[model samples]
Target: MKTILFKSKLIRLFIAFLIFASCSKDDESSTVDIPTVNYTATNFDATFFQTGNSTAPTIDWNGDQGTFSLSAPLAGLNIDSINGILSWDKTLPIGIHNLQVIITNSAGQTVKNITLSNPLQGVFTGFIINGNSEHLEMEFFSDGTIIVKLEDSGSPPTAYGTWTKNNTTIIANLTNPENGVQASFSGTLTIDTTAKYTGNLYSNPNLTDPLGVFEVVLH
Candidate 1:
């Protein structure tokens, strides 16, 4: 009877040990819970235009802290990985460029498209005047300042003035200090495969009589 009781107690101890070991193994093999990522806001649908100078628009984003990356590398743009701030100190090319922005965390990833464009605010050379090549250089500043220089013309051939645009109609008021000549130009800007602008030059601010029609193309 003593031997039987001892064996029964030993079996109960073995069973308890097995149950504890099984429970430990199950606990060790359990899967860890990962946090789900949720993006509250994103600037993916925003349109950014490249300024002629070193200034650029800022991209704002609000979401979970994750990694940020661009689909392809841009020439002069910089993107903040952790904060999602996009900035650039130089101008990009003209036309529409689609950028894919990717955000990823331990949970998942989110992707969106960002459009970048450069309008007609840069240095344009190779002016076509009256079906002839004038070989002039025109620099359009972002601050509405325009500077025109004659490539082959002699000294004091530069004109400095202010320019304003309403839609496709561009109005420029320029003055030449050498000859005290005030010139105004009115034109329409069209952007296709290249930027082509056609307009007429006038002498007065009212833009009464046309002097000559000119067209310029951007490279």
Candidate 2:
């Protein structure tokens, strides 16, 4: 009779152990980790624009929906708390500025680093070689405008266009006023004391046409 009771108690304990193990397994499987926050907007990390740019850039977030806040109050910038949009109304200073954004959600909080700047606003003189080399001057304006003079003899600009910089890469899109020929100059800046920008000139914006190499120095 004692053996029977012992056996019955052993069975009940085994069944209770199985139930507890199953419950623990279910709890472990049901756990979900927090998703990491990331930037979803285009041109948010490092954006370089000319000074007095009326069109402002925005910073949008992805992953967990959250509240947005800046590290400190920027002088010429504004941030939307709910939507995570950063706007500029007043004129920003003409130099590189580092910024940080803090995002807090139900899951967790994170910080992001960003770089904004107004750079490369000066006259660049160089030569473009297709069949023959021709002297040219490219003047980058403070308002995101560009004037390309085919001759360096103090002549008027032969084409007008816009300029933008991305990191160390500089891009200029120009259109001839007389013949409507579109061209683009895209190059990487040389990391030397001379501060020379060297690249090729494409006959079209798609950059498939193989024009000769060109080099320019900022004056």
Candidate 3:
């Protein structure tokens, strides 16, 4: 009886040892869960997935989003620092837009890219005079034309000229023979929804100078 009791105790200890060894092996081969982020956009979408061997990622919110129009604090663009999710509120423009996001994880820093396609093309109409007492107002045409209308001076002058827009700049030159004046004006124009240019003129020039900014919202 004594021998049997000793043998039984030895077998029980051996079984316990086997179980402990199995547990330790499993613990060493186990995998940890990594954080992942995702985002959705109507015009474009950007998704970011964390690596399995890395910890949380750090986000640097200071970066140029490669935008010429969507620039403002209240703009419809924002990024989540913790998750690296990018979102846009309103419609995108009609051109291609590329945005960059940098994520630093335990493994290393990873670069991400986002694309906003078919951005909402916008059109605006307005006039920029010399701001002097010439009273010279030229009409900007979508077909790249501008008509110079000299108030009621009765003298017809060179009222049409060529202009161009480089993303956000406007350059136009016109003459007011009725007022005996010729000048060129250039400035930054904004989308003025409060006013609209809807008058018929007597001249047409070939130039697509950006007058202002107006979005084409799909209602």
TM-score of candidate 3 on Cα atoms, chains taken together: 0.37
As for model 3, its CA RMSD to the true structure in angstroms is: 12.2
- Tens-place lDDT per residue, model 1, 1-219, is 999999999999999999999999887665333223233333322222332322222333332345777879875566677655556533343335577767666545666666655434677666636445566667777567998775444542789998887655988889987888888878887654556667887877799877777776654
lDDT of 2 by residue, 132-195 (tens): 7778787777677988888534565489998777766777889989879888988886533455
Q: Which candidate number maximizes lDDT?
A: 2
Q: Per-residue lDDT for 54-139 in model 3, tens only? A: 12233332321221111233234565556554555432222345666555444334455556543222233333232222334455
Which residue ranges in model 1 land beyond 4 Å of their true spot?
1-120, 128-133, 151-156
Could you give the candidate ranking by TM-score, starting with the highest?
Answer: 1, 2, 3
TM-score of each: 0.46, 0.46, 0.37
Selected candidate, larger TM-score, 2 vs 3: 2
Residue 192 lDDT (model 2) = 37
TM-score-best of 1 and 3: 1
lDDT of 2: 0.68
